[model samples]
Structure formats: structure tokens, C-alpha cells
Target: MPQTIPKKKVRKPQKVGKAQKGKEEKMQPMPVYEKEKIPFRLRDKVAIITGGDSGIGRAIAIAFAKEGADVVICYEKDDVDAKITASEIEKNGRKYLLIGGDVSRENHCQKIIDRTIKTFGKIDVLINNAAVQTPQDELKKISAQQLTRTFEVNIFSQFYMSKAVEKYLKKGSSIINTTSVTAYRGSGHLLDYSATKGAILAFTRSLSSYFSEKGIRVNAVSPGPIWTPLIPTTFDAEEVATFGSNVPMKRAGQPVEVAYAYVFLASDDAAYITGQVIHPNGGEIVNG
Candidate 1:
């Protein structure tokens, strides 16, 4: 519902700096969701979101901040975008940390949790949302390196982050992993990414079973084609142009739209829910 419809184009500004992303104020008109609709329901929580610098991660950061949670946003590069997300959190009158590093690395993974604890003292929520998708029409197109990196970032990071934060997480706490619709329905063009997403689903279910007794609930959010920065930069323009049009909604989803699910799962309202997936696809039947 963005006022100016989002085109699947790389929206680089005229002057692209270190991390000058064109989302917040620079979007042609803006993504449709209004901020006023959120009523600060998540007060007094500390949330850590990987890939929180932009897209669904940014939306989740802002939403948590609005609800009175201290937010920790982790990302690699995109300093401008990370800063913008932090600004929004601060503007909402909440404390936040902007972490820059690759989540796939074991040291970086542990560091994120360590820094979050050092800054916020405790972590109430962890959003494992960072991922990279490399589209390959043929299976052979995926090199060994790309395959390894894909698993490292898309799936392995979840294990690393979850293990790092498990000690601090209590019964009321929640961990939300970003799975993909491709997990349920295979992605012909994104073979490696699709496989990684499937692994994430398995990871989510297993972690939920393993930790539910300890009171740390685990869940996942599987999104279809959402208008995120990754799309423009990672995919071809034409593929991007028609990105979400195929969905039943006839348009792709916005990051904020999907962020709402994260907020819900992280909140006490979902205390009874665990090891489940909240699907925000544009009516794509992936057979839950």
C-alpha cells in the first residue's frame, strides 16, 4: 500500500555513499503501511534482529522500538541503512545498538550476542533474519563456494546466533527465524537458497523441540516476494519488475507488513505458540 508503488529497481540515490540506501525518506512515495496504526504494544523488551538494517529487519526494529523495546540491529555493511534504522529506534525513544559484521562467521555470531548482553544486559527476543539468495536457472550454476556461503549465512547463522543467546533467554522469551516460502515450495531458480530455507525450517522445528522444555519458544516467519533491498541488488531488473505480481495479491508485500508477524510472535500474546511458522506470502499455498 505504499503511496508510490514500489518498482523492482535498484533505488540507488544520485549520490550513493558508504551505505546511502534509498528506503526511509527516499522511496518514490513510501511503502503503504502507516506508522500510526501500531500502538506500542511491546514495551520494555530487548530485541536483537539480524539483518535489521533494512527491509523486514528495519520494520521489525522500528516496531519493537515503538513498543518500548531496546533494539539491537545487526548487519554487514550498509552502514547508512543501519544508522537510519538506529535513528528510527532512537526517535521512538528506545535504546538500540547498530552492529556491523557478517553473522555467518562464528566469532561475529558470538560477538553479536556478547555485545547485546553487554549493552542491554539481557536479550528477550532474537530475530534470525539475515540471508542471501543467489538465483541460478541451472543447478550447476551454484559453485561450491556459493553453496557453502549460502548455508553459512542462510541457515548456519541461525544455529550460531541461537546457541550464543540461549543462556540469557528465559521462558517468556522468543526466537524468530526468517524462513522462506521456498522451504515449503521449492524454488526452481534459487536452488541453493531454496535448500537453505528448507534447512532453516528443519532447524526451527528441531530447536523448538529441544528448547521448549526450557521455556525458550522458537518460531519462524516465512515470507514470499517482499520488496526488500536484496531483491533489487541481487536479481535482474526484469525479474525484479515482475517480482510479486504473480502472487494472488497482484503485488509483492512490504517489509513492514511482514514485520508485524515478528512482533506478534515475540509478544506474550503468542505464549502458547511455538515451533510454528507464520506465513505472510501473498496467498501462495505452500501446504503448511
Candidate 2:
């Protein structure tokens, strides 16, 4: 039989309501997840999580550490939050590295990998979780600066980090990217952010195919509205209060809830899974 060529999957754009993203900045109704008493499945593994100072990144950092991974936490600039997160990592009896800089810069990305290798001797897992969102009411409001900054921090960082760590990654090592439901369902307010997330989706799938030949796997998690600093940083008060209500679950998800998905994909349990997106968005389903 002749070998048949595989088909490339096409992505469809999703249209959503009109709302500005800054509406979520002032909200105080924080979402919570039940993560207590779970046994550490990632124990002793070495992983890197960008933006690990707070919210989803912080939750992932703690969860990964609990599962046995020494974590390298990279943040743009949050000294106090970073120190607190670092303190917790040490308290958990795990090694920790705090890297502060703009991940959008390739040189800084290289430095991150260098520091990780020097400190841990190897990189078993890489989680690209740092991102930014700017909700614009109108398409015209999405200035070139907004689009460029969004791509630089959100999509470009992934490229740099992946290239920087490619040589260090080996068989059984997995790469997890933090994509968003906005990529799947679209966000009226977060236009550029959604677009960059869509880029991440393509990047993850393509990278998975490239590396699967070597036993390295790549996957992603498309979280809906997990409470994070980004939410408070990007949206206003009332909007934050009603966050995640539109979903079938009728509420927002917590950072820890999303972290478990990362934990699963990073561990040996997901050895057979790659190039897939795990949705933990309070039951708001997307046809993936």
C-alpha cells in the first residue's frame, strides 16, 4: 500500500460578546480549588515555570514541587511575590531558582536555560505559562504596540524558550504550553491575547510532531478563567465578581485546578499523550 499523507487540521475563528478586559482588574471574588492531601507525583523532577511568582504560575510551582520537582521560577519583576514563592518552595524541601527578567527577550531566555542547567544539571520538563492580555473594546484599539507586546510576551517567549532548551530536553521529557480557552472560544475583549493564544496552539501541535520522533512529548492546557494576577491586573472590579459565570459550571476555576492538568502531562502517566489540549475550564466545553 502507498503511504498516505496526513491532513493538517484547520482552526476556525470564534466570535464572542463585546467587553473590555480591564473590567476584571478590581474583582475580589477569588476562585478556589481543592488540592490538599494529594501525594506528590512529580517528586524530584526538575521543571521550569515562567511567571511563577503568583496566581496560576504560583500554583503550578507549588504543585510541581509537591510532586517532587525542583522548580526554576521565572518572573518579569515581582520581587516580593517571588521571594514568598521561593520561601514556600524551600519549605517544601525542594530546590528553587528565581529568575527575573523579560521573557520576551531571547537572550534572557537563553540565560534562563543556562542558569537552570548550571543549577539543576538537566531539564526534564518545561512549562511555558507566562502570558499577558489586553482587552480592547474595538479592533482599532489594538494598536501595533499592543499586538507586538502581546506576541512578544505570549508567543515569542515560547519560541525562544523552546529553542533555548531543545538541546537539553531528551526522551520522556515533555513540554507543556499554557494556552487559553480564548484560543478555542475567542474573547471579544481580549483580541490580541486570544490571537496569540491561537498561535500557541499551532506552535504546540507543530512542535509536538517535530519532537515525537525522539520520544519527547509536547502538550497544552487551555484554561478558561482560573483566578490569577493577570485577571486582577487586566480587568475591573464588577467584571471580576461575575467572572466564569457564563460557563456551564457557572463559576471560574482556580489556579490549582489548572495546575493538575500540567502535572499530569509532565509526568510519566501521560507518556502516551502528546500534541493535545486538556481543558479544565469549569466544564465549559470546546470541541477540540
Question: Which residue pairs in candidate 1 have backbone atoms (N, alpha carbon, C) closer than 3 angstroms, thus clashing?
Answer: 1-32, 2-31, 2-32
lDDT of 1 by residue, 1-288 (tens): 559866765765554344447555654445555334445668888999999999999999998887779999999986999999999999989998989999999899999999988988989999999999888888888999999999999989999999899899988899999999999989898999999999999999999999887888999999999999889988998988899999899999999889989989998777789999999999988786
State every prediction's TM-score relative to the real structure: 0.85, 0.86
Candidate 2: how large is its RMSD?
14.1
The superposed Cα distance between candidate 2 and the true structure at residue 133, in angstroms, equals: 0.6
For model 2, how does the per-residue alpha-carbon lDDT over 64-116 read when each residue is reduced to its tens digit?
A: 88888899999998578888888888888999999999999999999999999
Whole-model Cα lDDT of every candidate shown, in order: 0.90, 0.89
* Positional deviation of residue 231's Cα in model 2 after best superposition, in angstroms: 1.3
Clash counts per candidate, in order, are 3, 15
